[model samples]
Target: MNPRALRAAGPAILIVAAALTTIAALAYGGAADPLATGDPGPFVRWGLPMAKLLVNVSAAVMAGSLVLALFALKAGDREFDGALDVSSIGAAVFTVASGAVGFLTFLDSFNPELSAGPEFGAQLGRFLTEVELGRTWLMTMIAAAVVTILTFAVRSWTATLLTAILALVSLIPMATQGHSGELASHDATVTALSLHVVGAAVWLGGLVLLVVLRPVLDARRVPDVLRRYSSIALVAFVVVALSGFARTLSAISAWEQLATPYGGILCLKVAALVLMGLLGAWYRRLLIGRIDSANAARAAKAGRAFWTLIAVELAFMGIASGAAAALARTPPPATETPYSSTPAEVLTDEPLPPELTFDRWFTTWDVDLLWAFVAAAGIVFYLAGVIRMRRRGDRWPVYRTVLWVLGMLTLFWVTSGPVNAYQDYLFSLHMLGHMLLTMGIPLLLVPGAPITLALRAIEKRDDGTRGGREWIMWAVHSPFARVVTHPLVAAGIFVGSLWVFYFTDLFRWSLYDHLGHVWMVTHFLISGFLFVMSLTGIDPLPYRMPYPGRLVTLIAVMAMHAFFGVAMMMQSGLMVAEWFGAMGRTWGPTPMEDQYIGGGVAWSIGEIPTLITAIVVAVQWSRSDERQQRRSDRHADRTDDAELEAYNARLARIAERDEAADKAAR
Candidate 1:
């Protein structure tokens, strides 16, 4: 196919392939078949997934375009505007499709009679307002509508970035309401699905953006944009692959299940994804560089090959996308165990873990896929930065690297190990995890100076587009960052969060909602990091408290920390009685005893890190003083004690004046 014609027909090819595949998969899996009892009819059943397919594709286009625009295209350029226009169009479709899906979901779920009657309208209203699934779609629609407007209005770098964020967030509601939510491992599945959706969107939508931009881009600019996009796609590929694997694990328990209809469809999707990955590798290694060949014919030939491959890539993406939609409607092979009326199962959506034991503390592992990914990415990126610095003959500290790795590992353990496994059952374990997250992890990470390393390691981009380094620098110097990273403010948030989280419904929210749980973890980590940075960070901050002032702040926070723990210890009534108190635990201490133990953990174990931070501060203060003395000695050595001589001369002059005045008075 002619490259120009292929580029023009790219989206059409994708949509057609996706539509055809969806119909076939639905037929194979019997997802859109008439229900045994409360069938919403063939139209509603078929239309729903088709609408969902539109939602997925449009959302990808919206998010992926904005991201590529930010990273690859210069602001105020025609290509940048075109990208936003594409994103806006995608968002508009997303909004309409989300609404359609919402309505279809109501029909499919409640099978309400189609009528203009008040009763029908009332039922629809109730469904939209009261039902979890209904509310999710409603929220998604609203977010999509908002994104539609933002993408159209935003032309600047900052505005486009914010719009891109909102576009990504709109997918979360969909992620939360999917089949993943019904799984035994609800949190893991939800996290995996969310990551999968976003990653796939970026990968697919970025390709779409490149195709749309190809006709407009000059030959010389093609390779650079493609090169940047390939990097984005590469990262997206990793995320999609990992998250898809996780989702697969959650959905299919046995190898034999792979033979089932749902698993067969999954295999098809996996095959498409694998082919795309290979295509990505092929072009990235060979074709992308050739597209910029100085010889015009060579460049055009490479461009044609690249664009044709991209078209094929889009078709595969469509196949994967269609299979995903079908999988959502298709039941997984693993039979879900019916939840008993056990309080633990009722709250957590899973059976109670075996009773806690000393050995189990180390052996027990309920991995939080989200945090596991985060820790892995953190270590990988940090090491990558170190390597980059070393390659450039820049000397990055080995100790800093070690500390960062240790910090990330500790974070992984706190989030995914025994603490995470038992936290839902044991208050003590939760508190232990919290302390490590807020105090211990930050203590190690602050010394690593990741921000400082990144500044040095990431090559500055001269192009108008914002890359990783540009964005990082902007965030560090942003007004909000300045306020939050203030010594006093960071200290306040660090100490105050302890009281606010436990004493309020926020703790209960974290217990019930995976989103809330992630928010809690993020909040603690950031607040702790800021406080530690103010105290002993090697990274540059806008403001740093004087060493004495830092010590004072630390002491005050420590006092509050101890008092918060004591308050927890003294609680006559359990906090979030419906949650922590009603966990139906049998192996651990009584709820009250466990609560007391939790308080003890906060008062004792939590303070160990604080004391260590204090000791670090003290040692830093001594070193600072020693450095100042050495500087003074060096200055004196250079000036031959000029300052001391000046001081002595001034004293002698004062004495002489005083003696002369006394003699005149006598």
Candidate 2:
């Protein structure tokens, strides 16, 4: 079909699907008895019966269509082929469904009986309370549809630019709307939700397109296309997984909830995700290898198997999305109750007025002395390793090993001392510890190329078949390798964990308990590693990004961080440790001092790493361009030389002809 016809089909199908879903939802709601209501539930009181049905059905349809689109992408067929047509239908259906859901919600806002529950009176009142979330999700689905359509028609740059704008627009409801009483009432939910929706769309949409449309494309170019998408998919998976985990942990409060029905559902979702990860690994290992070897039959077989696994994964993802919708309406477990403990209890029954303390690092003698020693030792070891390595060149034997050991020792010291001490107060010191462990330390260690160095060190110590050498290779080549490297999965984990910690009662719980601290520390380290690996060319992970694409990814991340910081600053209530008030640390130009500082960290200091990343990408791009230019210049010079030789021969032939004519005349 012509491009114009194809474009028309996309929007036209979407409009029809939306209209049908709206009609279906209205019919469904009308069929149910209006008074057939259950007990006044905490969340159900927030909306009308019809509104609820409409929203749920619309959400389901959108989510289901998203799954279809993801499967389509994975199918790997031609852009305008039958698979593409099917995927376009799915996109259109999701768009309409989302629109119907959003419109019904707006309509429900006008009904006086919608929020007539004893808990929260009036529909407007309840919606005002929960409008932020409604707006967030509604905006998200709409934006996803638009971006998906754009991806089919526009160039990557244009589509990406539009997607970014849409992402910003989707953040509005989250920022302005109040949270459910069960969850944190602060504005972090806005940032968290924004990340969640955008991450999910990019991940699911990319996969759908790849699955459905990849196969029908030019057969000879399939490997390159797959490789390109694989890299993108890996990043998308990482973002989705990290962000999802962050949101979950931030919302969940009590450890006991893990055994509850709500927690059980969450666990099931996680298990499904794990299974999906396994399927993805199989594809990378079996199918990708075959495609690389130009084995068309095996590649096709692997493709079919991959689609089956993706279909299963999508079903589970739908379950998870549905559960998420339910969870939004359900009160988080009782354990999530915020500020449950009295101020007196938190302050150890002290009747002292809160006082602000800054630059008090030296007050804690034990921590101070330990950190000092650690600093001194780290400096000494670092210098020693540098000197030794510089002298020995690439053959430097024990220096790299010594450096790695010293780094590990430093990490332990930082975590055990300052990290532990800060856990006691849950103050700025604790946040400092978090940054050190997650962002600062990882930055230093990753660039040191520890994995590569460790691999070489093992090879030197063993006969290559035994010890750590074999183990390193095994791990890199293992199924887990692809799971962690999947773009959607890893990104989900990285971004999700951050949301989970701050938004849930888990924040306070972690501050109160040792185990909570441990969990936080573990998650922080893991997430940091995954994020850095995705963005930076560090580990031997089987993914690489084109320069332009990497720049766009970096921009998207920066926008997210900036949005988070600004949103936090605008919040009226405290979102961090409540005991911050008890500790006198709450004093500043305003209560938002910490948030402002956080934003500063995100905006100013965050740019340092990003700048470094940009430079690296720029260097690579320039080097590639330089090589290409040199080749072109050499070829052009050769062509010019040949032309000059031809011209000279022609002149010589003319002269010979003239001489022959002169001889004949004589």
Candidate 3:
């Protein structure tokens, strides 16, 4: 390895040392034995955490290198290829480390008998196939192995992106683990942990990649590359900070818990994270502008300063990463959520929320961290884009901004408020959320024209870098996107998903699995957006039907929706009867009665958006006609009624010819 690589290795060294020391200290000194009666030896105890720490570092390198190569590094350059090489090696290490951790975890959790016999094989088979944790590890291992091979063989941007996705997937199983036993915070904890891992991987991995590429990069390109990376780092910082905060809130409910060893480790992690954030801010403020400048002197000075800054930032990031591993080993004050005895609470992570009065709709809150983050990010990015436009003296309509903000707020409320809380128990509230998600929310968002604003605000890259605009354009124009955004397909999905979801096993899947829930909401919002945008979107579409066609589609869709709602109301059979019926609740409507009310909501409240849509389509149709007429008037002005004159002249010739024929005959 180059001396430059040694410099890069410092952060990894610090992270490993810190994690090993912290975990070992916990094993020897603090708290009760995590192991059961007649525990496994110290090697198993220390080995598990050590393996986990290795997995984390390797994951960062694998994911970060791919991300950096995709976002910043130019193709076929030494820096880009080196990043890919690093990703390949990292993924290889990641595979071995993850498999080790899996083996260690199985031993830790089950205390299975040590043997190389048929009995051991049978137990191992059962473990891998039957248990959720085991299955997760098996999936992770498979994904990591795939990433290792792909990263080595493939160097294209698209292939690298796929490899990066697989690397991210490998972490998902790990994140979902250790969160399930905790009930009230189960879903949130899982989501938070998942985001934390991804964010940390990107941040930590990018920094490592930068260090690794120090010798390969040209001095002049350094500023531009770092500038590109800064925005990515900024987003990663927000994700890590928010997710860490969420995990903290879930773990420590009372002030006294902060006094414990677990809290101390958590605090250490937070402090390191906060310090790193400040360092990042300093880099953004002081170093980036100086670096991106074309002046040779300024660029040279900024380059040296940036290297130093990155080295220090990596150290701090290491501290956080290490403390994270240690924190995993440390036991929290609360694990199994308090009083998950009630069926409603056990199933939904909380008791059935208050009934859907007008008051409760605005009052109650049960946040889904994933959607909350999405909403917050959406609002912030939209406002930032609008602000950037204004700063550039470009005018964006106030109505568009207002509509975007309202749409984001509506999304936030529906996902993070009472609607989420009661949606599981009450079919009526679930229908309400569906209408808001699919109809009401899209109504606001489509008018906002977010895509147009983003395309305008984000700087265009001519250097063939795969930036945000490129990605967006690719999505819009790709074959899959083209098909999905087709007017007929969009309308079909919007209506068909509802029937297919409710009638099939998908609804139950959504209820039982958090990821399924995510899919349900995500699909609803996307399909709704596609359908609504097909009609009234100000942004460019691949192919927009004429206003008349749009109006016809709108009417047909509304008629179909009305029919669906009516059908829902007339149906006597329960949807997901087993899941909903079993949730023990003393209050509100019975499952059957609740299903009836849900149908009523679907039939009645669903039409309000349809009515609104019909009105909008009519207005659009009228304006389209007016625009056509204006175009005709302009044509008349330009030509001075030439076509009309030609038609009259033709008629006059025909009459003269006829008169001549009559005279000749006489």
Candidate 4:
């Protein structure tokens, strides 16, 4: 097909191609058939997959259009409007598809007779409330409907961002649908699947948006937009690959199991991904340059080449998406080994890691894919900023760069290493991770001065598009930042969280729920960063006390922090003894003793960072005094000591007046 024709037909081609491919794969996988007993018939089995296929495609369209719109297009422009329009339509489709799938699933799960009677309505209502699957889809449909309205009604940057976030949130329910199976790594499975879905959406939807907007984009703007889209696609490619690997690992036990039908489908998806990666490499290496720099005749040639490449990539994406749907339906190769597992395996989806030892801190590893991504991204962006500054003949401090790198690595180690391995069972390990995350990591990180670096490095966007720099600027100045970064508020959170967490069920929740653990980590880290930043950070904050005031703030906070540790040490009853004590560890100390060790670490080692903070604050205070003195001297030099001279003259006049009064009296 000609480029124009291909551009018009891209979405249709992807949908139809993916639908047919998914149907074929499902048939081959035998997911199109119901069980032999109490069969719900072919309709439920067949229709469910089709509805799922539709949901995936529409979700991609919704998320992709908004992501590109936020990243590349200018507000109040035709392209921006067109992007929003696509998002709205996609969300509407997603809503309808979600409802259809929910209904089909109700039929498949409960095998209720289709009826127009009130009884059927009551049955559906009960299913929506009573069953997890039914509730998941119901919530998904509701979220989609809301997204549809928001995308259609709002086109501003902030609105677009919120809408995109809601669209992403809508996918969370779908994570509960798949079979986590015998190992039951529900958290990992959900996380991996969610990342895969969002990444694929960005990967596929951005290209589709570009194709859809072809008629409106001139060569000048097209290359710029294409480059932006390429940047997003690159990130998406990495995320999808890593998340896919994680998801795959959880599915089967061994590499040899790839011979299974399910594994064969997975291989098909992987091959498609490999081909897409190669195409992306080709685009970056050759076509982007050609398309951006070519003349009229050559430009036409480049456009044709780029569009053809895009079309071919979309076809491969279709295969991957289709294969994914099929793979979801098929059962994986057996993973249940003969060796029995502890309760931890059933609770957390993996066996408890090996016994904790001092050597294991450096030797053992259990990477949280999400935080690994965060650490990697943090290092990558910081280095990129420093490089940009250096290339522009501006200097960023070498120490700041070193500190930033150290901070990121430390964060990775604490979150994904042996500390994380034993945190759930051992109180001492948990405290070690907490101390590092809350105090040690932030001390190093705050000195890195990321916000200051970002402000210096990222170019400002003036096209009414909220790019990285603009968003960062907005966030830094946002009301939320003002509140959280307030010295008093930060101090409150830093100290108060300790009592609230251990005393309440929040600590237990963090142990039991993956998301709660994430929240706990995030809250502590931010609270720590804010507190440190308030005292001595080089970065700009909304509000900071004078140097002496900062010193006082630091002193008060340190006392509370130390006291919290001391209180932990003094606790007669165990904290969360039911969970930590009941872990049945054979190697570690008794839970109560471990809690004592944890308290000691909290009191002594935690104070080490607090002492460091005090020293830094004192140094800053001394330097602040010197700076004020220098300013005073500069004022004297500027005004030639007029104030001092005036004061001396007033004293002389008073003396003369007193002498005259004395002479008159004589």
lDDT of 1 by residue, 114-208 (tens): 99999998998898889888888889999999999998888998899899999998998888745422323389878988998899889889999
Candidate with top TM-score is: 1
Best by lDDT: 1
lDDT assessment of candidate 3: 0.81
- Worst-scoring 10-residue span by lDDT in model 3: 177-186
Question: Which runs in model 1 stand beyond 4 Å of their true positions?
Answer: 1-3, 179-185
lDDT of 2 by residue, 388-471 (tens): 555666454464445445555656566645344443344334555655565556555555555565564432322111233454
Each model's lDDT comes to 0.89, 0.49, 0.81, 0.84
Sort every candidate by TM-score, greatest first.
1, 3, 4, 2
Question: Clashes per prediction?
Answer: 0, 69, 0, 0
Tens digits of per-residue lDDT for model 4 on 193-215?
76788898888888888888877
Q: Considering only N, C-alpha and C atoms within 3 Å, which residue pairs clash in candidate 4?
A: none
lDDT at residue 130 of model 4 (Cα atoms): 84
Residue-level lDDT tens digits of model 3 in 191-245? 8988988998898888778777767778667777787778888999999989888
The stretch of ten residues in a row with the least summed lDDT in candidate 4 is 176-185
TM-score of each: 0.97, 0.43, 0.94, 0.92
Write down the worst ten-residue block by lDDT for model 1. Answer: 176-185
TM-score of 2: 0.43
